[model samples]
Target chain A: MSREPIRDSVADLLADSGLADDGVLAHALESLRALCPPEAPEPSGALADLLRYGSEAVGAAAPSRAAHRAAEAAAGNLSPRVAPAVPLPPRKLHRGAAISAAVIAGVGLSASGVAALGGVDYSANPPQAEVRSSAAAPAEADASVPGQASKSPDATVHQAQAFAAAASGGSVAHEQPAAPSRGASDNALAGDGAAASSHAVAPSAAVWRSERSGAARAAAAAADDALAGIGRDDAAVTASQGAPRHRADSAPSRGRHVAQEAAAVAQALVAAGAEPIKEAVALGQQVRTVAPSLAGLGSRH
Target chain B: MTDSLTDHDLVAGVLPETELFSRVYQSLAPAVLGYVGARGVEDPEALMQDVFLSVLPRIGEITGGVAGLRTFVFSVAHARVVDHYRRVERRPRSVDYDPLLDMRAVPSAEAEALVRTGQTDAHLLIGSLKPEQRDVLMLRIVGELSVDDVASVLGKTPGAVKQLQRRGLKVLREMVSEGVMAQ
Candidate 1:
């Protein structure tokens, strides 16, 4: 005769989470032991017990003394994990690197470790020679040269105001944020020098739905984007503006150039106001005051 | 017990070192084994041991005391689980012939446990759920990690962890109700 056994898993589940104190989840999973049921192998030795509960908790058996030895032997030099030393291949210069190195060696280094040969030496302090250009370069539409407004120390204040005017139109326009997305400025207002048409209005909301050609609509949208310091998408601009898609003469390029000048002017003003360079600007004022006496002395000699 | 100890307090009170690592291994061994084993990692015990070997180097420097150690340990275990599947995908899962692994010599737990009865046990019951539910349950129940720790270890949000936990518990609760009704 054989006896049948009963095992209810729902009972098992309740019993498993019976230790869970998590108010709601307490009956779900109370303790960790439910995960590793009694049917799992009992740790036989200390080494194996490393993957088992502490020997003290289970009270299964006395931890074998060999466990310590095995752990130490197994774990020897395990701390401060060092990467295996990979055999590095012999160092050889690539063709571009070889050519650059050859060129540098031919030029050699000055005592200051800058290249003795002629390309720009960025490490040197900026040239302090008085900017003598009677007219500014066309980088700036209003003043031409960016830092030219600061021709003398007295011109620093005017330089800052000029930057603000160039960037946002004036002090009042500066107060208002440049938000093209908000439709604050409906037409070309960036003062881009090459804005072709004064009449190129931002299309009204209904105009996009009207039966206008795609090129006409896109050109109007592209003009608005160009003036707002937004995208410089070559394809969109080329469809409307007569300039080649990628050329610097394009309306997008002119807008970008104007923005670049505004930023340059801002940078020059910041450099003029920086405390590190404050003393240098003051020295310029001192030299200006002393120059008349030096001229008289030179004339008599 | 660790709730009162802030991460800073735990680190301030104890030095990170080998002794702490031993304590960690002693505490987390069972959980790691159950977690990796349930996830169906190849050679679960060996991989569990490898997790410790990796932790050995960081033994002294591990912070947040036991809770921090558990999170760190489980994070490694989770990564190893992912890596195991990745390896199985990249290369055909093959191992050198070992008699110990042969089913003819030794029947597996699932093969012995409920295959004979056609009844689902806890492992099979938990396994029935989706991977996310299973991960949340395993990390919550076996690893005994808080929802936030589970989120960090699993790289999920706490809300997501909570939702997964709720769904998993609901499935298990339904199974329990059904089993009771059948009985």
Candidate 2:
């Protein structure tokens, strides 16, 4: 145990080297015991005080062993370990599936909407079609009634007498012919008998007569047939209403007026029949086209 | 009171309320309290109590028998000292040694003797060092820890701890010598 020479050698090495290398210095220093401080004597009464304080404090801070176990049980810390989690699909695959499902659902919803619009019977929904038809029917009925003068000889003769009296500047009865009237006849005849005779003859009769320009005349005739087909005589109505006998030969202005009158009458009749039919045919075509697609969708489901 | 209890026997609560636990408490608490006090902690006794209370539950996990248990207790004490300073938001200062106050108001003959012996002066000098240096010195001397154990508790490399120990002791020795010279 008397390693004095070794200690002295290490100490001289340490002093000479100025403790350059930490390992050697530490090793040399460990052998020199006096360098370390002596342990201080324990202060009196300190141990007893510490023990008493520790016993009380530890008792207060930590519950008894049984109570601690109960606490751990209550907190579920002592419960069996939980089962491992279910393995999830990879993130990219899951996301791709979600996006694909969303796209498919969107397409299906769009197709369903299109099918509902095309395939549903809109006419069966009385509130929609019936309201439209009810509103339009009265106006059409009223318009076609005056044109019916062609079907009633007496009404035609009455119109004819009125026209001749209007031409001669003699007072005569101005009646509405108990029929629906258009602007052409209404403008020409809607006046007192004396006023009708006093005023110059309406140029609407000349306008109708000027419709003799080939296809334009054919169009006028077709309009007349449509009127008659609906129980309104266009030719008789025109003649009785004093359609100009010779197209008002000198008044080129009167010819333009007649042409405008004829066009108005034709437009009113065509709108009454053709517009609804065109819509119905278009709807029928749509339903026929989409019905197969909807059936296929149903089958797939 | 045998110091030879196995780690398993201690950890299994076989020593609770036993003479062995009392013996262990008696053996370690004083040094721990002294170490805490020398750190200039506000409540050294309370901190020592806390350190022992913390050690009680985990006695079973301690390895290396009595020596390991001693290291564990001191480690708890060291942590408590650090925590005290952190909580108070100020570093521990050197205790002012008033020999007049010590001699006149001695509560007991033992306190009077302790004060007369200049141990309080030694503690004041140790406290005057930087906190890390004080920690290295205190743990080495009062906690009776090896340099490696001090490093382990303080979370420094063994080499660094040795350097701190060497420097701190050198400064403490010089301070003590100066006080003696002044006296």
Candidate 3:
């Protein structure tokens, strides 16, 4: 083939190369030349010299790239290799060392450890005379149905007496039932009056009875809630200053005993001049009635 | 007239460690940078490094001596562009390429002074085209890819590229002519 034809064919083939189309490449190059100057970065003298030195060194160097690669490969393979197993911390292997130590100490002094850990005295039991007598009396009463010996002021009291003796040699009972009477009043006002006065003294019993009076008031409230459905606006009811008429009429039917108990208790509490005891008693009764009514409402809901 | 260099000969002669490769780097690095800059690389020098690194292995495959090597380096740079985009795709798209990075040529301090002083209406005119047209035009002009390359990249045909380019140029020309006529 003629050189001209050969060159033209070669140029055609060059155009055919998938790398770039001649037209786009030509335009791009032209635009690049126009846009960017060749002398954009002035090379530093030191950098130029470094480059020259590196190039000259490579030109004259004895070790080829392949040889260098081989040497690097050999170094990688032949060098002594040590991958020591990571030393695990003692805590990692024995996860709960402190807990294990505690367990071991507990096991060594088993009974004391159980008591200490449980926050109780295992050697010294709560004086069992009361528990034994109480447990025996229940069985004895079961055997003899007519005997009311089990009801004789409770074995729990004697146990309390014994505990009191142990606590401070029976001086606690003598020093004051009055101080504990306050505690008794709180206990009496704790639940329904029977439950309240279960161990309550005269003062606590009076307070519990007043709580029964509050029950009268609450019964009146419940009757009102029943008639008015408790849905009546309190503002309107309070503004009216009277309960719904239907409840007002029926209040006496259920409230007479509660009222009598309340008045008597109130008189006793007033005589004693224990306002907190009186209030607690009153609130207890109120709570008793309210609870039932609230329960009824809940059941409906 | 020419002894086509083998890979071994090329590695020994024209690689980075050799004299010929350094000369090629000095001569072609700027042109390659300009090419990449024109296509909107923020740092064309970094792009030039990438191009050379890619082409270094396949230097002997390019047939026509230094100019041929230059073209091959550009092709490698173009491939690097595809790689850059792939990397960019992996990144959060919320991070935007800076708009200033699109300026291929930064004017010199003197030229900038003069240009600022001059009464000029120098603005991006491509904004006049519809979004699709502008996209096609930018890909063709700045990407320096053929119609087929653009089509393949866009999942279209060369015919589609030609049509869009024609329509976009026509609309731009009409807008300019209309503005001129109005004046």
Candidate 4:
């Protein structure tokens, strides 16, 4: 039932086997035999034993689920062994010290308030009225100079006559023509009735007063000349018959005369065309009025 | 009885571990051992353990049963032999000692003398050949590897391996015939 290669195959195999029961082939085989392990007659048997042991070891050492579960439980039981962190105690809030501090602060504020109010003048009127009276004193002085000038017209006229007589070589002759014209203008101004009425309210009250004064001075000079001419006739009669009546009249008239004289002198000066002196006097008066306040300011500095 | 049952079942059943593993070890171990033993290794058991230990881990890779194993074991054994030879070659040369006269392990004077003479013959014969020829011969005869395996290991063409083998054999034959070495 099996196919075979003929006897020729056997002869070929025997020839290649190189076995005269022992030949080069035997020597080659012997060389291999010599290299074989002394204890392992068959190297393949040892290899098989190793393989069996390895397989059995793998099979016997299979992982167990119970062991795996136990390991998992042990791992799960391992919580971090954490110590409890101690809490810090609450801080004490001292209200007593806080209230004391607030009271000190309130007292400080109240002291500052009392210091501010203490500077106030509560029950006393200040010296503003006294200051006002002192401030009015310069204006009173200006008024007094006008009154004094009204009573000195005759003296001023004589002084002016003297100066004119001296300058004109002792011929102190009055210009009677100029007198009538001046008298007519003065009467016109006085008759306006408005100028006389507005003596208290006129914005040009100083000019009106000055012009009235000039007319009055001219009238007084005329009266003084008449008297002087009468006195030239009889010294005794001039002194006795009219002297007492004249003297009584003179005292009353003297006040009017003095006012007229001062007016005359001012008119003579003005007629002499010296407005520069008038302006200088006005400016001098203004400077004198402002001088006291200036002194007060200097002292303050 | 259970071991017998397992053995019988293994031999007869689907997975034949007893037969497969047993055949692998039995058929191959001797060739590997003989190849290693010829190299004058004193401890053949250690070498045998190494070869099998290496092979056992990779035993599942044998695709074709005996033929696959034959190729693998021989290749591994050859690698092991080459490794052993390289290590031996690296040993220090006897400086104050005589290598020929160091025969303390030899049981008899005749054997000692023979080994000394063989050593001399080997030195002369191998020394006379070209380095390439000697390499080929050593890989073939000492390493116990086939010409093809030798070519693969040496990274040479099979033609070059054949050429080197022929030259080396020719040189050895000439040396023996010229009586350059004692028979």
The DockQ leader among the candidates is: 3
Which number leads on lDDT?
2
Interface RMSD of each: 12.0, 10.8, 12.3, 14.7
User: For model 1, how does the per-residue alpha-carbon lDDT over B42-116 read when each residue is reduced to its tens digit?
Assistant: 678766666665554444455556676678777777877777787688899677998867867767787765564
If you superpose only chain B onto the true chain B, what TM-score does each candidate give?
0.76, 0.73, 0.47, 0.55
Better of 2 and 4 by lDDT: 2
lDDT of each residue in A1-301, candidate 3, tens digit only: 0123223322332343332344433322222123334343543343343346653433343332332333334233323467768977887868788789889888889977676676632221223323333353353333222332332222222322322232222234433132233444344335334434444454555554555445333433333332232232223334454444433223221232232223333222322323344363454356345544533332232
- Tell how far residue B50 is off in model 4, in angstroms: 0.7
Each candidate's fnat: 0.07, 0.02, 0.10, 0.16
Candidate 4 C-alpha lDDT tens digits along B1-183: 011122222232344554555555554555456455544455654565566555544455443344334445555555565566666789955557776666675557887577666654455566677866755654454344556656755557888887887666556656666766544
Tens-place lDDT digits, model 2, residues A62-97:
633433332233224212357658766688549988
Predicted complexes: DockQ each: 0.05, 0.06, 0.08, 0.07
Could you tell me which 10 consecutive residues in candidate 3 chain B have the lowest summed lDDT?
B1-10
From the highest TM-score down, the ranking of the candidates is 1, 2, 4, 3
- Candidate 2 ranges beyond 4 A from true positions: A1-59, A63-301, B1-17, B90-119, B176-183
Candidate that scores best on TM-score: 1
Candidate 1 local lDDT, A1-301, one digit each (tens): 0001011222333344452333333333442234553332333343344334432332443322332232343234222366668754445426677789888876664533553444343221122211321123233324233335435322332333333333332342333232122122222223332322322643454442131222222322222322243232333444454643233323333333333233333324222222222333333333333333333332222
